[model samples]
Target: MSTPKIPILMDVDTGIDDSLALIYLLASEEAEILGISCTAGNVPARQVAANNLAWLELCGRSGIEVALGAEVPLLTPLRTTEETHGPQGIGYAELPEPRAELSPRHAAQLWIDLARERPGEITGLVTGPLTNLALAVKLEPELPQLLKRIVVMGGAFNYPGNTTPSSEWNVAVDPESAKVVFDAFSGLPANRQPIICPLDVTETVVMTPEHLARLAEAADSSPIERPSSTDSHGLRSQTSNPLVRHLVDAVRFYFEFHFDHKQGYISHMHDPFAAAVALDSSLAVLRPATVDVELAGTLTRGATIADWHGLWGREANALVAVQTNPEEFFEQLIERVGAFARTIPGI
Candidate 1:
């Protein structure tokens, strides 16, 4: 019998965690990636697009469609910090230049087309600003009904944000877009499961030293491609040389960025947590709740106020992730990485 097809669409900013999530999704036999929509945040718009393409190529799954999303927030200025991904987004991978043509139809339009083509069966794996998604809903107004779910990596319920005191990076980048998605989702009935992996739950899981070492070991042993004189590290050789040197460098830079800048040794696998939860709902403890985005406030803009107290007797519109089984998630992540590693050349 043929494997059952699980269709998924990804909206990402191509950060290190986003790359990990991509790898995880590709490794799973449960999913058939329909496409990836690139947005801006940790990297520049163009670079993030390139990073997405490079990852697709590296996975040997170049048939996946890659669409470029909004470069700036719907109602806010574009914000990018190299702190998380270096200037290029994939750390210092100095990724090979992408020659692929950008999709003519903007990400929002592409989203609508995909939903209209395969209504009620496509899952949105969102890990960046919701500009493209909001644009789609605002333009069509009937898309929410067609979506399987929106797995978003944003906001903060129990934990503070990485970008601000009360705002997560994805939402903080575009609160207006976030509000649009939340409102549209709320307008939909409870049948549509809009699961949110907020910072509170995501931060609970971090890239432990052991996990990083394992990932690095995978990269070191892989036969993946390497960068040349034009790439970041500028190393040139092919005889018994590691092809995934760039991946190891990316991990090292990611760790250093967290350690030196955040004063934390381990960075939260925020985006991947959302992806994992999206792939397998049983991996985390989930609850149904109503969530609202704070669009205006001196210090609380972009805050996701989840109503778990039942103080207002409000109906629930979102599924809030309360907890996760870290061991299970890590085990699955490691297994996927190992599989990819075994396919690489020159350990």
Candidate 2:
């Protein structure tokens, strides 16, 4: 039997990992990307949208619509990670100017419209701050019921944060928005709650130098297959496809960052792992929990407080990922992405 295609809407900040997540989803036959909503996180909202478009164009999936969302947090100053993602948000990877235009509708409205159009069929994958989603929830209070599932890549849970000792970058960038989103989902039924891929789980899913070498080897060995037509739609394919090369370049920076700063050579598969789990829930071991953001603590602000033991006697609002099979995750990523690279038309 054929696998059913999952309609998905990705809200991204288009950082290095977010770009990887987009590539993974584009390559997967199971994902029917409905649209991509860009927000401010790793870079500015406009830059995020541009990166999304460039990636989609490079992947020959530019038919998908891209929209720009919140330039800053709902109630806080915008903070970006240009140092982490590099000036262009993809390290040394260079993509051609995007030929596609951003959709006129704002991302929040697009989310609401899409959810209303196909209620309970669209999986909303958020790989950025929750600003756009928080606004959507406010505009459409029934959004939780409309979306099939919401997968978020944020928070630190029980792990030390990349941003601070207690908070992750995504949540820290926009704590108020995160709080609104968490509270909105918390009031929903158990089944309608979001599935959070916090740092506690994502940090465990690492990509080593060995994995990068393998991907590079695959790209080196792949044959160049160009399309017959020279139309604008034709993709630029080559033995060293842009996707693979870009992944290598971008990840090398990430690997170096981890090595120098975190004293490790392996980069955490944070956003991509969230996308993977969103596509296949069986990839993770999730535990029900009531999660909230620390809003008022001076130093602990934006920290995600997960009630793993139900100490607060509150109902579970989100499913927190605690375990994942890294081997399986990498295997699936390589297999799907490698296959997609081989089909691209000429460099």
Candidate 3:
């Protein structure tokens, strides 16, 4: 008998890396994307839904259920990273407006209803704030047990924060919701616990211009384009392949941002790496820990703390990614997404 395809319920903010993550999952033959839940993070929830719908239409995979979540965090005021992603959250890429309609159900209700319908079969992948999942847990207390497992891309355990000196972007966006999630998901079995892709490891998964060129080459696109720092800012890719061109344009803005911040002209593929690890946990070595969110602090609100030792006296609630082979990961990403691009109707 053929092995069953893994059901993936993805919750994303549809930022650039989140876009790549969505495409990467679509490329995987074994990943059955049950549905997508859009939330406010990189951009607003409405724009996020539009971005997702457009990408699905662009990739010729329409009709997939896309649900919109909360417009703001549970407690904190909503903040978006238009500077990091573009005004539309996809940088220079311009996709036509989607023709598909969104699911009528709210994102939180979608999550709860899916878990109830597919107990122990659905795996949650959240690459944004835990707002929707938190709200879902509040409505359905047995969510953690009903799902097979979860993979999250947030936090800054043992690593400096990207948002502030103490907090990562996603957690910083919604600490109360994160607290709600961590508290609700406590004490799950080790294998079933959330596999969190913290900044400690995700910051190491860098994507250079050469990687984009390689991705284009993998798709057999002409000219083998390489974006350069010397080029004018906002310079777009004129590659023969449309998908590669959009990817180049999107990541070119990411490269420029990193260069301006003195982190080199390399973009961190955080959400894509999280998506990959969600599909195959063997790609990285995980260390079990009792993790929590710091909700109230003089200057450390929204920081995530992981107790590697037994000081917390709590059972391990998360399996944190500590190490991964970047080369292997990029290889898989290029191979999968690039080949999938080749199969597009217009390609």
The collision pairs in model 1 are: 223-344, 223-345
TM-score of 2: 0.93
RMSD of 1: 4.2
RMSD to the true structure for each prediction, in A, is 4.2, 6.1, 1.0
Off by over 4 Å in 2: 219-239
Flag the better candidate by TM-score, 1 or 3. Answer: 3
Each prediction's whole-model lDDT (CA): 0.77, 0.85, 0.93
lDDT of 3 by residue, 88-178 (tens): 9998898888889999999999999999999999899999999999999999999999999999999998899999999999999999999
Order of models, best TM-score first: 3, 2, 1
How would you encode candidate 2's per-residue C-alpha lDDT over 237-303 as one tens digit per residue? 2435667766766776676667657557668889989999888898999999999999999899889
**What's the true lDDT of residue 222 in model 2?**
49
> Given candidate 1, what's the lDDT at residue 203?
76
After superposition on all CA atoms, how large is the RMSD of candidate 2? Answer: 6.1
